[model samples]
Target chain A: MIRLENVTKVYEGGTIAANDVSLDIPKGEFMFLVGPSGSGKSTLIRLMLRDEPVTRGKIWVAGKDITTLPKWKIPYLRRSVGTVFQDYKLLPNKTVAENVGFALEVLGRPRSVIAPQVAQVLELVGLADKAKRYPRQLSGGEQQRVSVARAFVNRPPIMLCDEPTGNLDPKTSVGIMRLLDRINRTGTTIVMATHDHAIVDAMQRRVIALDEGKVMRDDALGTYEGLGEEE
Target chain B: MSRILFLIREAFVSLRRNLLIVAGAILAVFISLTLAFGALVVNEILRINTLAWQQGVHVIAFLNDAGENGVPSNAHEVLLEDVRGWDEVDQARYVSKAEAWIEYQELFAGQEELLDIDPTILPASIRIELVDIALHNSVKFRLDQQTQVVRQVTTAADSIEQLQNLSRVLNVLGLGLAVALGLSAIVLIANTIRLAIYARREEVAIMKLVGASNWFIRVPVLLEGMIEGVAGATLAVFTVWLGSTSLARAGEGFALFRLDVGQDWFLSWGLLFLAFGAVAGIVGSLMGLSRYLRDADGTGPDTPAGF
Candidate 1:
C-alpha cells in the first residue's frame, strides 16, 4: 500500500514538476499513471521511490512515512519498493541473468540464494533461455523483460514502473504488460506510469491522471482519456 | 566474505576497463614517491657525514710563535682559559710547543727531512671542540678576538657551515618538490577514479535504485585506487632499495665514507612510504566518489520523454 497527501515537487529555477497531488492505493492493486508530457507522472513515481524529495506534504509507503525517513535509510526504502525504468536500465556488459540477479546481489544476498530466485524471475519474465545474453544481444522487449525480472527478483511488496513499455513495439509492449499483470496476480501492488493508450484501454485497471502537476482523475477500471476530464 | 570478493572483483574490472588512466596514476605515484624517498635518504646521509666530520676537528686556534720561551705566553694561556670556560667549548686542550714537537715527530716518523725541521715552527695552539657543531661559528668568532696571542684559526668550519646551509636548502626544496608532486599525483588519481566511476555511471545508478548501500557501490572503487597505490609504492621501494644498495657498494670502491644507512632506518622509511601510498589512494578515490554519492537523484536516466 502507498499513500501521498498534498505532495509537491519543484525543481530548481521554479519549475513545478508536481503540485498538490494526493492519492492512496490499497495492496495488490495494478494501477496505471496516465498523463501527457510534463504532467508530474514520473515525478509521482520518483517521490514514491524517494529519488526526488517532496517539496511539500507527506508520503507514506508500505505503512512507513518515507518523507520523514533519514537519508541513511533511503536505501532501505528503495529495497522494499522495486523500480522499472522506461529504458530498461540494464548494464550493457552484464548478461540477462546478472542484470536480474543484481537486485539480490545489491541486497548482499549470497550467490546460493540469488541463483534460484534469479532463475525463477527470469522464467517468469519468459527470458529463461536468454539469461546468458547481454543487453545489446536482446531485443527491446527482451531488455524490458530483463528489467522486469530484476525488479521482481527480490519479490518486493510494491513495484513502480515508469513507462515500462515506452520504447517497445505494440506486440512487445503487450507481452511486457502481461508479464506485469502476472506479477500483479501474485498480490504485489504495481503502480505504472505510462502513455500507452492501447494497453491502458485493454487492461482496464485503476488509472490516476495528472495534468501540469495536480491529480485530475482517479478511476477504478478506468479508460484512457487525453485530458482525463469527465464528459 | 563473498560480498568482499564481489567488491574486489568489481574493482579489478574497473581498473582494467580504464587501464591507461590507471597506469598513469600508478606511474605518478611511483615517480613522486621515488623522488621524495631518494631526497630524504640523501639528506640523512649528508647529515650523518657532517656530524662525523664535526666530531673530529672542531676548531684549532694557533698561538703566535713569537711568545716568550719559544712556548705559549700568559696571553696564550689566557685565551685558552677563556675558550675553555665558554659553554660552547666541550673540551679545549692547549698543545704547548713541546707537545706539538712530539706530535709532529710522530706524524713524520718515516720522513727524515720533515722530522729535522724546527719544533718552534709548530705553533702551540688551543684545540677547541664544541658541544654542538652548529655553534662552531660563535666559538671561532669569540676565539678570534684574542688577536695578540692567536696567530690564525685553522678550521674546516666555514666549509662545514656552507655544507650545512646547502643541506638545509636541499631539504626544504626537496620536501617542497616532493609535496607538490605528491599532491599532483593525488589529483591525477582522483580524476582517474572519477572517470572510472563516470564510465559505470549507469551501473551505479541501477545499484542505487536497488537500494545498494553507497559503500557497496564505492568500496570497490576505493580498493582499485588503493591497489594502484600499493603496487606503485612497491615498485618505488624496490627501485630505491636497489639504488641505495648499489650506491653503498660503490662507496666501498672509494676512500670516502660509506653510503650505507642503518637497516632499521631504511625499513622504517619503506614502511612509511607504503602507508602513505595506501592512504593517498583511499583518500583520492573517496574524494572523487563523494560527488556521485551525495547525489540523491539516482544516476538513472532522467530524460522525461513521456510519463
Candidate 2:
C-alpha cells in the first residue's frame, strides 16, 4: 500500500513536476496513471521509489514513511518495490537467467538459493528455455519479459511500471499486460504509468489522470479517458 | 567469506577484461616506483661514499725529510708523537718513506708511468684521521703554528664539503623526480578506474536498483586498482635489485670505498615502495569515485548519473 500527503517536486529550473498531489493506493489493487508527457506521473513513481527527495510533504510506501528516509536506506526501500522501465534496462552482456538472478545476487543471496528462484521466475515469464540467451538475442517482447522476470524475481509486495510496454507491438503489449495482470491477481500492488489508451480502457481498472503537474481526476473502474468523456 | 571471494573474483574478471588499461596502470606504478627505488639506492650509495671520505685521512702533515738511511729523522718522529697527542686527531700514523712509497704504488698500481719515480721522492707524512671532519681545520691550524719538521699541512675539508654538497643536491633531485612521477602514476590509475566505471555504468545502475550497497559496487573496483599497484611494485622491486647489484659489479666498486648497500637495505626500501603503491592505488580510486558516487547518491544534477 502507498500514501502520498500533498507531495510536491520542483525541479531546478522552476519547473514543478508534482504539485500538492495526495493519493492512497491500497494493497492488491491495479491502477493505471494516464497522462500526457510531463504530467507528474513519472515524478510520482520516482517519489515512491525515493529516487529524488520530495520537495514538499511525505510519502509512505508499504507502511513506512519514505520522504524522510536517509539516502543509505534508499536501497533497502528498493528491495521491497520492483521497477520495470520501458527500455528493459537489462545488462546486454548477461544471459536471461543471470539478468533475473541479478536482482537476488545483488542483495547478497546465496548461489544455491538464486538458481532455483531464477529458474522459477523464468518459467513464469515463459522464458525458461531461453535462459542462456543474452539480452540482444531476445526479441523486443522477450526482452521486456526478461525485464519483467528480473523485477518480479524477488516477488516484492509492490511493482512500479513506467511505460513498460511503450516499445512493444500491440499484440506483444497485451501479452505483457496479461502477465502483469496475473502478477497483480496474486495480491501484489501494481501502479503502471502509461499513455496506452487502449490497454487502459481494456483493463477497466482504477485510473488517475494528471495534467500540468496536478491530479485532474480519480475514478474507480475508469476508462482511458475520464468517465465524463464521450467515447 | 564467500562474499569476499565473490568480490575478488569480480575484480579479477574486470582486470582481465580490461587487460590493456590494467597493464597501463600497472606500468605507471612500475615506472614511478622504479625511479623511487633507484633514488633510494643512489642516496644510500652517496651516504656511504661520503662517510668513507669523511672518515678517511682528513689531514696529512708532511715531515721535513727522510734520514740518510731511508728512515724518518728523530725530530720528525717527535713531531708525529706531538700530532698524535692532539685532541682533534683520532689517530695519527707516522708514515715512513717506505710506507709512503708502498701506499703510492698501491694507489696507482696499474699506472706504470706514475709508479716509475724513485721511492725516496715520495713524501714521508703523518696521516691523521680525525674524530670528525670538522676537526680538520683545528688540526691544520695546530700543524701550521709549528714550523719544525712540518713542510706543509694539507686538509681534505674542502673536497669533503664539495662531495657533501653534491650528495645533497643529487638526493633532493632524485627524490623530487620520484615524487612528480609518483603523482603521474596516481593520475593514470584514476583514469583507468574511471574507464572501468564507465564500461559498467548500466550494471552499476541495475545493481543500485536491486538494493546493492554502495560498498558492494565499490570494493571490487578498489581491489582491481590495488592489484595493479601491487603488480607494478613487484616489478619495480625486482628491477631495482637487479639494476643495483649489476651496476655495482660492473663498476667494480667504481674507484670508491663505499658502494656497500647490502641486500637488507634494498629489501627495506622495496617494502616501502610496495606499501606506497598500495596506498596510491587506494587514493586514486577514491579520487576517481568521488564525482560518480556523489552523482549516484542523488546529490548531483536533475538527471541521476548512475548509482
Candidate 3:
C-alpha cells in the first residue's frame, strides 16, 4: 500500500537526508527499517506522512499520489496513516482514555460513538482499569501501550512507527513488539524504524537497511544484521 | 454542531490550563474598554452641557437712552420688531429699565451699598435666544447695523465658541487615548494567547498529526480571546452604569452640572463597548495564532518532541 519512486529529500544546507530511494511494500506486510542515526529512515517515514515535501520523484500512499498533493490535503493523507512515536506523545493532563479518544475526537466523531470505541481500544491495550489515570501516573510501558491504543484507535490501513520502543526497556519493548505484531496480523501494514537489534533479530521480518541516505539492503526475511551473517 | 461544542470545550480546557494568562487577557480588555466607556460618557456629558448653554439667551441688543422719541420710541420698537421676525431668533423678550433694575437688586440682594444705584443707568434691551448657536455672529451683526436705535449688541457667543473648541479638543484627546489603549489591549491579548498556545503545543501537534482541521484547533483560541474581551466589556459597562446612577441620584449637591446621561444612552454605548471587546478578542487571538502556531501556508507548525 506504500510506494516511493526515486524520492530525494535535501535539507536546507544541502544535506541529503534521502537520496534516489525507490521501494514498495505490498498490502498486509510487516517491515523493519534498521539504521543508525541520520540514516534516512525517519525522513522516509516523514515523506510518507507528507510532513516534508520531496525534492524529486513520486510517492503514493493508500492509492493517492501525495507528492503533488496540495498543502491543504496533507491532513487527509495523515488521517489514512497511523503514527506511533518513540517517546509516546501523550498529553500529560489527559487520562489514558482521553489520550486514546483524542484520535476519534479529532475526527469529529459523536460522543456516543467515541466512548465505546475508546473503551474497546483501551481494553485491547490491557489498560481498561487505567483509563482514568494520567500519563504521569502510568508506567513507561503503560504509557507506550496508551500510545499504541491511540494509534490503533482509528484502525487505519497502515501504521508508521518511528522508534516506538526506543525509550522502553527490553522486556517492555518485546511486549510493544508483540502488540504491534498482533496489530499487523489484522491486515494492517506496519513499517517500523528502529535501532533495537535484538528485537529485529528475534522477529526476522522483512528488513530494509539504510546507511548514509541510501538503501543498503532489502531482504524478504532478514535479521537486524542482514542475511548470511555469522552469529 | 457537536463539533463546535467540542472545540469550545477544548478552548475552555486550554483556558483553564493557562489561567494566569487568561486572566491577564481579561484584565487588559477590562481596563482598556473601561477607559473607552468613560471617555464616551465624558464626551456625552460635554455635549449635553453645551446644548444647555446654547438654549439660554445668547445675544442681547441694548437700546440707547437717547432714542428718536423717548425710551420706548419708534426706533426702539422697530428694532425689537425686526429682531423678532428674523429666522435666527427663537424667542425675544423686551426687558424694560425698571425690570432690569429689579433683576439687579435681586442678584445682589445682600449688598446694601449696590442697591442705592440709579435705575435709569441700566439700559433697556431685547434678549434673544437663537434657534442655533452657529447663527450668533450673524444675529449680532444685524443688531449692530441698526446703530441708530441699538447702542451696543453683546453676546456670550465667544464663551460658547471657546467651550465648543474645548469640547472638540477633549474629544480628540479621548479618541487618541482610547485608540492607544485599544492597541495595547490587542497586544496584551496576543501575548496571553501566545502563552496559552505554547503551553498546548503538544496537543496542537497531536491534533495536526491526527488530521484535525486547522479551524478545529484555531476556534478554541479565538473563543478564548473573545471570552476575555466580552467579560471585560461587561464589567466596564456595569461599573460605568453604577457610577452614573450614583452621580445622577446625588444631583445638584456639589455645585456641579447636571448628570443628564440617560439610561438609553448608556445602554447603547454599553452595547457598542461589548461589541468592540468581542472583535478585539477575536483579532488578538488570530494574530497570536498566526505568529506562533501556524506556518506561512496556513499549516500547523512542526510537531515538537512530545511524550
Which candidate should be chosen as best, given DockQ against the real structure? 2
Clashes found in each candidate (C-alpha, N, C closer than 3 A): 0, 0, 0
Query: Which parts of model 1 are misplaced by more than 4 Å?
Result: A226-231, B61-69, B72-128, B134-152, B244-263, B296-307
Report the lDDT tens digits of candidate 2 across residue range A1-231: 999999888887778888999999999999988788777788888788887788899899999999888878888899899999888989787789988987887777888889999999999999999999999999999999998999899999999998889899999999999999999998999999988888999999999998767889999998777433311
Model 2 over residues B43-150: C-alpha lDDT tens digits?
888888887787788898887675644444587877878888888878988888889998898899999999899887777888999987877788898898866667
Give per-residue CA lDDT, model 3, range B183-295, as digits (tens): 77788778777777777777777777767767767898899999998988898889878887887778757434767588899988889888888988998888888654455
Question: What TM-score against the true chain A does chain A of each candidate get?
Answer: 0.96, 0.96, 0.96
Better of 1 and 3 by TM-score: 3
Clashing pairs in 3: none
**What's the residue-level lDDT of A211 in candidate 3?**
75
CA lDDT of B11 in candidate 3? 79
Question: What CA root-mean-square deviation does each model show from the true structure?
Answer: 4.8, 3.2, 3.3
Ranking of predictions according to DockQ? 2, 1, 3
Candidate 1's residue-wise lDDT over A34-102, tens digit each?
888788898889889988777798999999999888878888989889889988889877789988887
Clashing pairs in 2: none
**Candidate with best TM-score:** 2
Q: What tens-digit string does per-residue lDDT give for candidate 3 at A143-218?
A: 9999999989999999999999989999999999999999999999999998788988899899998876788899
DockQ of 3: 0.43
Preferred candidate (DockQ higher): 2 or 3? 2
Off by over 4 Å in 3: A226-231, B64-69, B73-78, B109-120, B132-134, B145-148, B244-259, B295-307
Residue A230 lDDT, candidate 2, scale 0-100 = 19
Cα lDDT computed for each candidate against the true fold: 0.83, 0.84, 0.83
Pairs in steric clash, model 1: none
